[model samples]
Target: MSPPTITENFVDFDIPQAGKPCKTWYTIYGDLGTSKYPPLVVLHGGPGMPCNYLKPYGQLASKSLIPVVLYDSIGCGNSTLLPEKRGDGTFFNIDLHMNELDNLLKGLGIEDEFNLLGHSYGALLGAWYAATRKPQGLRRLILQSGPASLPLWDEAQMDLRYQLPKELQDILDQHEASNTTDSPEYKEVVAEFTRRHVCRIEPAPKELQETFDAAARDPTVVLTMYGDHEFETNGTLRGWSSINELDKINIPTLIMNGRYDTAQDKVMKPFFDRIPRVRWIQFSESSHTAHLEIERERVMEVVIEFLTEDV
Candidate 1:
């Protein structure tokens, strides 16, 4: 049977990147709904991780009576890649990303409006958008498996690193000291770590696995943004935590995480405590990717209720 999602094609437009603007493309999953129903704009994680895991969210089009838009940032996924800004582009910074999103919304005719559903790094992106840009049209914000602070991410990954077998930990330790993460042995270790807590579904779903495979082939962007392995953040993203400063967000927010997620130290506590209007829901089976971890019915129930329920 065909999936019930309604897909909308897009054309490229000049979106800013590294101080200069570049062409970028975006896709929208439109459903039978009106402007009264906010278009949920999805921001994917990984400074470079495409909006792939979010592909399952297309299911929202079929299930919910609303519009959902999915787009890749400047140089990742289906968006245009700017090799000119390859390493030193300001595009990697959060402020630039926020602005890019702003411009995209305006160009695409959704500016200052629409709901935000950010996962992983995208959650931080959403938090920044809400706190800093303060888009006037946002109705409710949904953050899944997001860390309020970069330090929280660091702390969580540090723990995940230790969870590995002593022997595996030794390999990782050696790689860190030698900067040999590209070694075949290291790839094996990375796979082992992912199998444990990244996703509970054995072999993972095809859509989810395709995303992982894409990362494996050209991980430069992911590594450049998140660093080697999913356990640590010693890359350029160091010192970028937000938990302590999350109080700036003055909007309705939904925080989600999986029981086995790498998000650490009662991860949702600070978000709920600091953000006056917030709700936290734990997905029993999902770690980082709740949308795909559990059954479709279970996943959409929370989404429908949260997105459509009386606020």
Candidate 2:
């Protein structure tokens, strides 16, 4: 029950198009700087959401002696906030994140040796990086509730939408059709959907809540990268898919999601079938955020085993 040893800092990241550099906040647990084992770079979901919820993974540093790194990917949390970049879709594309991640790794001097664990959008970013960059040192990868194809995820969400209460569906349809998704009615319906598919917990954990609060305070990146809400992809990231590039990733991979996740089994299946060395596991009782929602210990066990094996 001892507190985790943690170190937090900010690294300067150059955004060429922006013609300047911004600080990307990062935190590390355990002795990654000196450990023989490659550190684990944990990517939080929400091209905009902060990495607060992923804090739970820091326990790995103490329990397994594996260094765990978490960061607020530019524009949210402790990182530089640019409200002016909110509506500029081109400015918040996947490449923006990829570049920032690359810079972060190089700055930490671990670009040559590290494991990647991405959640949701973070996983999408990881897949894109691995398939494209093929970083020489990436030894393993973990995709938690990640979507192989944005279109596939939308289809699954559409299916779930049909099951919502008729009144709720009407509210959603009304707001979406009118381009007034900011309406309270629409938000309420989305919250309902979120409860069932995003995180099943009645009241989300404090850290998770903090991420949401951060997003609310500055939704520029979220709106530009992922639109105003989940279950919908109306931003720059639409049509994104890594399914075709799965074969490019040769490292050991683990695909995980909850049965009730927004990124359901069908959407995740392509990843398992396409990746040469991969394993898939579904948390039946959980939803999107399985690590914090339920089965945290089990997730850690599998993760540590996969990362440490043959290392």
Top candidate by TM-score: 2
Candidate 2 local lDDT, 1-311, one digit each (tens): 56668999999987866656689999999876667689999988888999999998998887778899999988889998888787887788888888889899999999889999999988888888888889998999999998898898889999889889899999888887899988787888998999999888878889889999998899888888777555678887788889899899898899999988888888888889988989998888988898888787888898888888887
C-alpha TM-scores of all predictions: 0.89, 0.95
After TM-score superposition, the amount by which residue 58's alpha carbon in candidate 1 deviates from its true location, in angstroms, is 1.1
In model 2, the clashing pairs are: none
Local lDDT at 277 for model 2: 89
What are the lDDT scores of the predictions, listed in order? 0.73, 0.87
> Cα deviation of 80 in candidate 2 (Å)?
1.2
In angstroms, give how far residue 282 of model 1 lies from its true place. Answer: 0.5
Q: Per-residue alpha-carbon lDDT of model 1 for 8-45, expressed as tens digits?
A: 55444554334454555566776524535778888988
